[model samples]
Target: MGREFIEIFEEWALDYDKSVMGEHPQYVDVFANYDAILNQVVQQSLGTVLEFGVGTGNLSNKLLNAGHNVIGIEPSEAMRNIASRKLPSMTILDGDFINYPYISVQIETIASTYAFHHLSDIEKEIAIKKFASVLPRKGRIVFGDTMFKTEADKQLEIEKALDKGFTDLADDLNREYYPTLDIMKNAFEKHHFDVSFKQMNDFVWVITADKK
Candidate 1:
């Protein structure tokens, strides 16, 4: 993970949920959709789950309540600490998905939400390979995030940010890679995953890929 990305999450840890959900109250519906999607994927297996970037334990808490054992990989200590508090029984580790150590376990599902976008395009490709390596055969990956189908589409959104005088944010958007659906599908397929997805909105998407 990049230093800047980790730092942002560290600072946002305290107010992350409130700011993210409160700033865009309409997104409450979207989060509900995310939760539902994750639930569906997790229900397919009875083994443990590994959630990448388990920010503040939102989805982790839900999974725990649902009786699935979960282990989380989070780069930000502040965010990890908060998540650990909420899910004391859960193993919330301190590393990003790209570099986290692999262990032999019966991992049935790997899930991430709104966090994978922090990685660059190449990093995402490498990370998926790591995900494939750690998971058991037929293990599934459930990912949700802001993804675009093309650079031109993402550019249009950045242009809107500039028009609103959010230059800093526009600059950030310019660097934050949102994968085209085809790109994601190809990457996962190369690693033996059968991919499928649903767009929750213009910006948010939920992808389900089962190991083949």
Candidate 2:
């Protein structure tokens, strides 16, 4: 199922950058805040970092400029190809989170922005376990994505998005699994992660966890 979704994303890769990258008006500021949060998490200079779901190399470029050795794992070949072209110096892998190649490497930090919510609950749990298994002790995992405040809040947001042409009804239908922050925190905690969360905006939040 995940593989199928990746294939679809790969097929859409040509237009993905134009469609997704920096399309939102607040994207730059949002990412800037995320960079600040990430800077706080690393504390010192960073070592090797793995960016799961490095879509279009947008955040990848930022991480590279921050002096981190970054390996970006992206499921879509189209997206990977785009990232490779943009970030020729960095390593880009066309692989899924559940089956990436470099299991032996002890990653110091892992980051996924706006991508983790695509996973199902079961797959997310598996991926979290895998992340914990490969990370060094005290390694950090930073993830950011949208979270609904309540079922009513979600419905209202979807309605507003449709009315404002912010998103299509089809897109809203596909996004049936955007979990709340509390749910995400519990999931991470179950995998022995000491988690902290901050609401970044009306629709988005960031979660940073350290392997316990």
Candidate 3:
């Protein structure tokens, strides 16, 4: 399943930026807000920062422009290829977040966008624990993704898409999970992180957690 998803996303990566990255004004606004939120949460100049699922280095470029050393972990080779071509200075690693190899270098801040929802419940929990284990005492995590109001609502969207016969290449991509806000907050709390949430849109939520 994972391999299939990666293959689909790898193909999507070919035109992801031109097709989806800047196509939505709302998404751009949300990213701007998220960047401000991250600046405020870190409370000091950022040092070493790690971004999981840093597809195409869009946000990674923004972080670098803000004067931080950025390391990116991406699962899709196609995405990494785009990122490398776009931002050669970034240290990009190819691996899933659940099993990415990292050195003992302590990360002061971490951020992810539009990626956490792809993780399974157990995978999310383990990933949160792994992040906590490597972060310093005051480290922070900024995560945001598409969120559903309810299972019924999500089903309705799926049904609508299917009815429209919207058989895009993305339809072939495997999305293993879509966690509720409660589930995400609880998972972070379980790892000793103070959590807060903000609504970015009707279908998206931004969460920031700080290590306690």
Candidate 4:
């Protein structure tokens, strides 16, 4: 469902890690507390994990280090190749949030970071329903992404970006499908997930949604 952004990620594969490392000026805040963010997600995750958008395998590496069985899903071939080379033993396949290969092992938790916004609100709901179908009761989804608490907060952030002469960042803010907290809460609740959100940085939040 989010395949339209695959080309952008494929082209950004080589530079993606650099950007996440706080080298990219516009994205420094976005990746702020990057290691901590991954750790938070990893800490909350349980058993086997299915990770979406394994860009450069940063979060995947963390999940692996935490001793969970990690099955990575990525839509960008270039990104997948990079992750494969980095973590040769992990099962990384070409896939996205709404579409992935069938796994023989049970998935206890679905995890992702900075990538869920690739889906629009409707697509997010669809994806949540798909995850509900895939998961048993008490199975969880731990995700971290850029989301605003309200529409006004989102607009204010966009204006602040523009005011700071961050045209590219503003463009990205407008371009990406970053959802408000209410929208995400509704999506998860509609599918019977007991969801909660925690701020990770100026721009990111960690979501722990346990299936009910």
Candidate 5:
């Protein structure tokens, strides 16, 4: 399933940026706050940064322009190639964030956007713990992605989708375990990171976890 998603990104690479930024009504409502959310993430970040799932280098480009050294990890060759062209001097690793061998000494902060939802619920918890393992004290993990407050919150969204005749989307949301803000906070705290949540909009949020 993961490979299948990566393949989809490979095919979508050419138009990925425009597709994401375009004013599609279904997405525009949530994505409208995209830059503002990222701006908050950048404000919290410090020193050298590692970005997982750095698609097309949008956030990375912003971070670089903000004068931060950024290393990126992207799974799709096509996506990585585009990001490389956009950020010619920065190192963009070709690998999966869940399996990537992250070096604590090298990374000062880790950030991701609109990508972490690809993980299963169990995988998300494990990944956060793994991130905590490598993060130096005071290092932060900031990510903005589609998230909910609880299963009830997700169900409400699903109901709205169904009302709007997006049956397929509703079904997909049912199958995907998008984490709640509280769930993620507990996961980070379990791994000894102080965590906070900022809802960027209705469906997407930014989570910051600082290693203790």
Candidate 6:
């Protein structure tokens, strides 16, 4: 579970929308093309969507506007509240990637954005397996988050952030579970998902995994 960062999210909740809009200097690259990134995930989704880490409901709103029934799971109460305010009629539950409720309903696509890196590698593998168990054939896991092409590339990014005097960015890079593409690919493929990666910006990548 990525609940370790609940406190951080609680504090960041008020300013999250602004941060995503590129108001913050450090996170500009991290959230480049924010709307477009959410749109990409929205486009891939089908039928009912189970969204994990529904931070502030930005992606959730997109899904709902596209006419998909959206079930949101966010661990932070503050986040859940903001998302609820955004979409009042919808229910945004308290849960995470590895631990979330799925009512007796057909979930055709699972989606997340800017949040999966909170889970450790093992946790990610477990979450993917859980998705494999729940999603039907031709179902998808469309996630747009920060993923490095290689371990060396990840290190270079951290170093670049440090050189730019963005110690917080570097610290985030070191602290969280930002992994290489190879690792993510293995996790999904092992669980029988046909995965593809599309780099959205200098930082984020959209990973679309379809259940075989």
Candidate 2, residues 98-146, lDDT tens digits: the string is 8787645668888877677677777888899888888878888887776
lDDT leader: 6
Worst 10 residues of 1 by lDDT: 22-31
Candidate 5 achieves a global lDDT of 0.81
Q: How high is the CA lDDT of each candidate model? A: 0.77, 0.71, 0.71, 0.92, 0.81, 0.93
Alpha carbon RMSD to native, model 6? 0.7
TM-score for each of the candidates: 0.87, 0.82, 0.81, 0.98, 0.91, 0.98
Worst 10 residues of 3 by lDDT: 166-175
lDDT of 5 by residue, 97-118 (tens): 5776555456788899888888
Ranking by TM-score: 6, 4, 5, 1, 2, 3
Could you tell which candidate, 4 or 6, scores higher by lDDT?
6
> Where does model 6 exceed 4 Å of error?
none
lDDT of 4 at 135: 88
Q: lDDT of candidate 6 vs native?
A: 0.93
lDDT (0-100) at residue 107 of candidate 4?
A: 92
lDDT of 2: 0.71
Clashes of each: 0, 0, 0, 0, 0, 0
Candidate 5 residue-wise lDDT at 209: 87
Model 2 error, position 90 (Å): 1.2
lDDT of 6 by residue, 1-212 (tens): 89999999999999999999999898999999999999999999989999999989999998999999998899999999999998998878889998877568889999999899999999999999999989999999999999999989889989999999999899999999998999999999999999999999988999999999
Clashing pairs in 5: none
Tens-digit per-residue lDDT, 57-95, candidate 1: 887887787788888888899998999888788888778
